[model samples]
Target: MEQESASGLSGRAGNAEPVAQTPTPDGAQIHEDYLARARRGSIWQMLAIALSLAIAAFSIYVLGRAVSAVSLSALRQAIAATSAEQIASAALLTVWSFLALTGYDGLALRQLNARVRYKTTALASFTSYAISFTLGFPLITAGTVRYWIYSQAGLTASKVASLTVIAGVTFWFGMAFVLGAGLAFHASAISAINHFYPLINALIGVSVLGAILAYLVWVTIRHRHISIKGFQLELPGLGLSLGQIALGVIDQCAAAGVLYVLLPSHAELDFFTFAATYVFACILGVLSNAPGGIGVFEAAMLKAVPVASEEALLASLVLFRVIYYLVPFLFALAFLGAHEGFHRWTSLREAMRGSEEEKVLEDEINPLRRWYRDNWRLRR
Candidate 1:
């Protein structure tokens, strides 16, 4: 009987099904491919970071060498020679530039169909640009600032990101337009600084302008959307696109004007020519990935603009840094701090008010509780 029971148990166990331990060939291959792609993405990211670092380091070295040529005493003399009128003009232009920057956010808000107030849009735009301008990585810094402010206004994370991207596009449109116009009209002037032939510069300028025109026509015809990593971005219509181009040009020109006013009166460079040089220098500085384009911008300016007074040029660059980059950065920091403090205070006040109301209710309920207790005791 024991032998028969053991055999029956063995047969039952054998009939029970078991799942396979190994994955199918196709499944295994898919997983391996996914891992390979991930590895490649990581490698590419590392390479990009390394390249940025290298460019920044090299630009800094160049800046250091350029500064060594000008004497501190001469620089001081040059700065002292600058008229109060010029300083005032530069300051005014700085304000104008920042104002135009606010329009970038405003336009982005319109594109997103987010009905945030004008004040909120200005705050988000100005603070983000101020912070990002001084910090090197605009994408991260600007996006964070926008998200922080816009989230309170009910903007989703993706919407904030789209806003940031749209704002960036506005800036590029302005930059490309100015650069192209300057190059096309005054290629000879630019060629003197960049060493490119006039014909080539003109061709490049024409190509850029053509591209912008084509984009404008395309958007005018119908709605256009671009998909990036599963995120869909709708392009603005013709009117909005025109507004972007205008704002961009104004902003870029104003920013460039800040430096232009600081240049020596004897520099002999016209506004259009100087603007192109300034834009080119800015592009190089941006590419270097240094904070505020610090070392790179100064180096490029020194190389491109032919100033008779090197000391004056150096002094102008120094003042430009202070007026444009440093002042805004400090102001943004203070504003952010004050904004956070005020928000906290408001929240605390509301919380305290709620707690007081709760205490008053509890106090009123205490008398009723005592009355009920007495009645129940008497009845018992």
Candidate 2:
């Protein structure tokens, strides 16, 4: 009876399956299901991308038609009437204004203690701006490009992303300064204009204020031991934050001046009014996301500056694009193309050298193999 009991226990123990072990067939089926879901997700993403591209193309076509309908004769006359000196000044200012944009990146880098060469910073900055100009989505391509370039300098992806975010904050801070100053100094001028959407102005004010408050809260939370990955920026004290705001105001003032210089000399608009109108127009253009805000920007300017004729507005907008968007865009393209060309050439040269080395090794190996075979036959 005891032997029988022991034998029964042993048999049961031997037949028992391990608790933690999963069956291979079941695991494989689960994996196959996951793969199917992933494929479906990939298809959805592709469809979304296709849809977005189609919409963007359609918007561009519609905008192009609006531009083409503007009187060419008036455009030419406005172009001719623009003083050579004013145009030259505007061009110079546009270049300098963009150069100043690099300062925002530099400041952020300094804050993050990520030391990089000036040339690298400039290239990253310019390439980012250029991509933003052409692609209409600044953050996507610009961030990717920055990661590619800055990663080589020992900066992690998170740190680069942090710097980019900080740079954007500073830019908006500057914009607020321009808007606030324009509002304060030209109260009468702003009140005189009829805006299609008064709510937009209110919204702009609220957004800026909300942003500042949010930044403050973020700083407080971070100070209490919450850490943000890749960005080691401390909440700059109130004074420092104010100083950044001041810098922003200066930047936008310079930007607005570039457009102001291109406007007709006879247009009875004060600096403050021009600044206010320009700010509104810029906001509209940015929201439209037209490539470099091309058609959208012109349309916004026309709407904002109601005193100016459509022809005059169109002419000024075109000239502004020429100075600010088109020229810088072309230069940035050339710079990127040259950089890429050099990298490609170097890669090709290395590939050729690798092929030559492989051929030499093959040549030596073939002779050795033949010699070994002949010796083996003799020995046999």
Candidate 3:
């Protein structure tokens, strides 16, 4: 009977299945595959970052060379010839113009339903303009920086991008209006330049058409039936579009005036003629991709103003830079400093709040109490 019982137990043990183990090789293979994918992704990301840095470095080097080649003596001569009163007036006007530029950002933000404070918006606008002027690449210029700042204001990336695009359109539309109106009314000026360089008009026309086509494509893509975060299409209507166009005219007129004021007193160029030349020169400068359009702007201005002597034209360009670029640059720097300081204070305040919360928890726990101490020790 005992032998039969023992036999039955051994049979039961034998019938029970073995516990399954995960295959080490399969686990290792999956880990290796994940590691390989990560390595490949990292390599590509590094390569892209390296390439971008290299391109930026090369561009800066080239711009530096161009700036060094400019005649400082001529620039100084121009500066000396400019009247102090005129310089002050030009400076004031330049500041006012830049303030108007802040409206571009305001309008864009309003469209995006991101109503930032006036001070914050002004800082963003000025800093962006300053960076764009200094960097010369609009993509890398102020827009990226503005996006960062605006993002901190609780805006999503897509909203910031849309605002950026709108602001860009505002700027370009103003430029185009200035260019078009200048060409239309100052046909004589256009005729003179076109007679000399027929290709200029063609190039301008092509650029304008290309911009329009690009905008249409962008709008079409955006207006397609798609939703992001429960939000449908959020584009400005025809009324806002017209308002943008009008703003552009106003902005460009002010910008062109900066150059016009710097010209020699005897220069036989009316506002329309000046605007035509200014727009062409500015377009050429932007195309050159030179920092602040430094050498490019000077050269183009020299070419456009045939009535003025080369020296006089060079002088005018220098004065224009001082009024429109340098002074604004200083103000932008001040604004950036203040902005950073405010952010630092806000961060400190957040840290203090976190510390206060920690203190409150400490007070509630009352670590000095025997039970609390015993509980804390148990937890540890």
Q: Write the per-residue lDDT of candidate 2 for residues 1-380, one digit (tens) a residue.
A: 89999999999999999789665678889999999999999999888677655545654665566567777887799788888988998988777777777777787787678799988898888778767766677778778878877886689988898778877777778776566555555655565574424455545556666676676666645452224554355645454466567666666777888888877753578876777677766665566555666666665566456544566666777788777777878888788788778778989999999999997787687988767777999999
Q: lDDT per residue, candidate 1, 188-300, as tens digits?
A: 99999899999999999999999999999999999999998999999899999999999999999999999999888634778998888888778877777777788888888
Q: Candidate 3 on 297-374: residue-level lDDT in tens?
A: 665555556653455666776678867887777877887787789899999999999999987788677857756777
Top candidate (lDDT): 1
Q: Sorted on lDDT, highest at the top, how do the candidates line up?
A: 1, 2, 3
Best candidate according to TM-score? 1
**Candidate 2 TM-score over all chains jointly:** 0.66
As a whole number from 0 to 100, the lDDT of residue 231 in candidate 3 is: 50
Each model's lDDT: 0.89, 0.72, 0.72
TM-score of each: 0.84, 0.66, 0.68
Ranking by TM-score: 1, 3, 2
